[model samples]
Structure formats: structure tokens, C-alpha cells
Target: MEKIVSFIANLINTQKQFIKDLKELKNHKDIMVKDDEKLIQQFIKKKAS
Candidate 1:
């Protein structure tokens, strides 16, 4: 019984960590997308001028 309890606790912790990592990754992707958009805008302005 003790072993089963410990195993379940470990699994829960792993899942929580996985969720946190996924959220961080998503935020990084969002920032990269915004940066890319700004670069594209600058390129367009430069081309127009």
C-alpha cells in the first residue's frame, strides 16, 4: 500500500511539472510570434520607402 501511494504521488508531480513546462513553452512561442510580426512590419516599411 505504501508503494502504491508513493507511485501515485510521483505520477501527480510529474504531470504537474509537464503542465508547467507546456505553459512556459507556449509563452515563448507567443513572444517569438510577436517579434516576427514586428520584423515583418519593419521589412514592409523599408521596402515601401
Candidate 2:
């Protein structure tokens, strides 16, 4: 599950540069529905920081 989530996050990251902020990732509620929220949140937070 982590691997799958990581892959999905990686895909999302392709557009992350356009994101412009960590808050954007936090507001993307639809992502929580498609993947593990904690995992994705952590990943995005770490990368954003």
C-alpha cells in the first residue's frame, strides 16, 4: 500500500511545482479519498518543507 501510495504521490508531484504551497496539498481533499491521507499528507509536507 505504501508503494502504491508513493507511486501515486510521485505522479501528483509532477504537478507539484505548480502547487506553489503546502497548503494546497492540504486542501486537496479528493486526494484523501483516492489514497492514504496520512501517507500522502506526510509525503507532501516533507517535500513542501
Candidate 3:
């Protein structure tokens, strides 16, 4: 019974950590997307000129 409880606790902690890492990864993706958009726009403007 105690082992079962400990296993559940560990599983919950692992899930929480996974969630935290997933959020950070999502934020990083967003930042990269914005940067790419800006670069594309600049390239377009330079090409048009």
C-alpha cells in the first residue's frame, strides 16, 4: 500500500515537470516564429528596394 502511494506521488511529480518543460518549449517556438517573420519581412523590403 505504501509503495503504491509512493509510485503515484512520483508519477504526479514527473507529469508536473513534463508540463513545465512543455510550456517553456512552446514559448521558445513562439519566439522563433516571430523572429523568422521579422526576418522575412525585412528580406522582402530589401528585395523590393
Candidate 4:
């Protein structure tokens, strides 16, 4: 009974940490994508000029 409770608590904690990490990763990916788009646009403008 105690062991089961402990196991469940650990699982919940792990899941929470995983969710937090996933959100951070998603945010970083979005920033990178936006930066990439801006870079591409600059490259295109330079090429055009």
C-alpha cells in the first residue's frame, strides 16, 4: 500500500517534469523557426538586391 502510493507519487512527479520540459522545448522550437524565417527573408532580400 505504501509502496504503491510512493510509486504513484513518483510517476506523477515525473510526468509533471516531462510536461514542463516539453513546453520549454516547444517554445524554443518556435523561436528557432521564427529566427530561421527572418534569416531566409534577409537572404532573399540580399539576393534580390
In TM-score terms, which candidate is top?
1
How many clashes show up per model?
A: 0, 0, 0, 0
lDDT of 2 by residue, 1-49 (tens): 9999999998898667545454565566754534556756666666778
Query: What's the TM-score of every candidate structure?
Result: 0.57, 0.31, 0.56, 0.56
After superposition on all C-alphas, the RMSD of every candidate to the true structure, in Å, is 13.8, 13.0, 13.7, 13.5
Model 4 gets an lDDT of 0.63
**Model 2 off-target regions past 4 Å?**
18-49
Q: Write the per-residue lDDT of candidate 1 for residues 1-49, one digit (tens) a residue.
A: 9999999999999889766654554465443544645645544454478
Cα distance off (Å), candidate 1, residue 18: 0.2
Q: Which 10-residue window in model 3 sums to the lowest lDDT?
A: 25-34
**Residue pairs in candidate 4 whose N, alpha carbon or C atoms collide under 3 angstroms:** none
lDDT for predicted candidate 3 compared with the true structure: 0.63
TM-score, ranked from best to worst: 1, 4, 3, 2
Segments in model 1 whose C-alpha atoms lie over 4 Å from true places: 29-49
lDDT of 4 by residue, 1-49 (tens): 9999999999999889766654554465444544645655544454478
lDDT of 3 by residue, 1-49 (tens): 9999999999999889766654554465443544645645544454478
Global lDDT of each candidate: 0.63, 0.65, 0.63, 0.63
Candidate 1: worst-modelled 10 consecutive residues by lDDT: 25-34
